[model samples]
Target: MPTLKQKPKQRPFCFSVKGHVKILRLVLTVTSMTFFIIAQAPEPYIVITGFEVTIIFFFIVLYTVRLDRLVNCVFWPLLDVINSMVAAVFMILISMLALIPETTTYIVIGGVFGLAASVFCIADGALIYRKLLFNPSGPYQKTAVHDRF
Candidate 1:
């Protein structure tokens, strides 16, 4: 048993240093957009968004290297891909609507951003947790779903 006074060992976050950089990039991308940035539809913004998206895709495609045959096959990458997609969707919507004259558009952008961002953040945390906390060998194991059963 671990002592209450002892600190838990720091777990490696699921991301490589490159992965950490991508995570940081996403954080910056989400926070960097302002009403003004969204209003202009600046070329730089589009470029940055595109770059972040590409990074997200690369992470999903490459995520399997760290994870083995157990739970990593589908679930981990699936969760991450969904998380990135949801974030991108809101960011896109918010950017498109921020310049519109309608107040409802502003409300919609804010509301969706709030909701989607929450889920994205949770998924991000879970990815890190899974990288650090999950075990491949255990008393409870991953069982394949049989099509016939």
Candidate 2:
């Protein structure tokens, strides 16, 4: 029997797969954006990368603070998966665009980072999808152990 002083041990968010992916996403976003800016990439590419960086930053803070648990109205994991998938798609598109033959060295570097980010995004989405499938959460969650049949 544990005493009142012995609180349940909780794993840090940074140690989880989700957290690792999120951090990777943030790093990639910032790095690519930096390279893109330095390379003087097109306005559209810069704007798109900026938008993605903002979104990724928002999700990082949301998960880090455990706000997802507080906001019962939203299915955060699903939203995160959707965001990751969308970001991956956008990143792939922009990365391809940036990697054209006439592009500068910095642009090529940015494109490489962008491609890497997209791969990580896809991985993140897949991992979250598996988690949701195996361990359902939210209001309508029903586990096999609870079933009487």
Candidate 3:
């Protein structure tokens, strides 16, 4: 009989509070970008929204496969917090720009979506920050190196 090797299965991390937040971020960003396109928002606004969508999607993938654990050189949680904060700031600024008077209804809706996304981003960053601060064995902690026996 021929033998075949099988890889161990890993659990999906994208269903926790952090995971839910990331999914929400993606959904809101996508909706906002669609509305922006329909409303013909400024190029920068559309581009920034696209960037946010990409970043959020990247994090979702990273968490889904537990890649953050394998790549131990970088402090993933801190990096994620920084990303979330920056995303929130950018989203709020662009939403404000989109909510100007005389803007189309689609723009207004997009601006609202942007605002909601920003709030979630802030919440995500805060959650990660708290985890790092309060938990001594948090994800941000570096893993100990051990030699093969």
Task: Please list the C-alpha lDDT of all candidates, in the order they appear.
Answer: 0.49, 0.86, 0.89
What ranges in model 2 sit over 4 Å off? 1-8, 134-149
For candidate 3, list the clashing residue pairs, or say none.
none
In order of lDDT, best first, we have 3, 2, 1
Error of 1 at 130 (Å): 3.4
Q: What are the per-residue Cα lDDT tens digits for candidate 2 across 93-133?
A: 99999997647999999999999999988998987777667
Q: What residue pairs clash in candidate 2, if any at all?
A: none
Clashes of 2: 0
lDDT tens string, model 3, 1-149?
99998987744677577788789989999999999999898899899999999999888898887898899999989999999999999999999989876479999999999999999999989878876776645455555566432
How does candidate 3 fare on TM-score?
Answer: 0.81
Q: Among these predicted structures, which one has the highest TM-score? A: 2
List candidate 1 segments past 4 Å from native.
1-40, 64-118, 134-149
Task: Estimate, for each residue in 19-115, the C-alpha lDDT of model 1 and write its tens digit.
Answer: 5644664554544433224544445545544554565555544553545244544765455546565655655554444435444443444334434
| Cα displacement (Å) at residue 142, model 1 | 28
Candidate 1 vs 2: which has more lDDT: 2
**Candidates in order: C-alpha RMSD to true structure:** 14.0, 4.4, 7.7
TM-score of each: 0.31, 0.82, 0.81
Query: lDDT winner among the candidates?
Result: 3
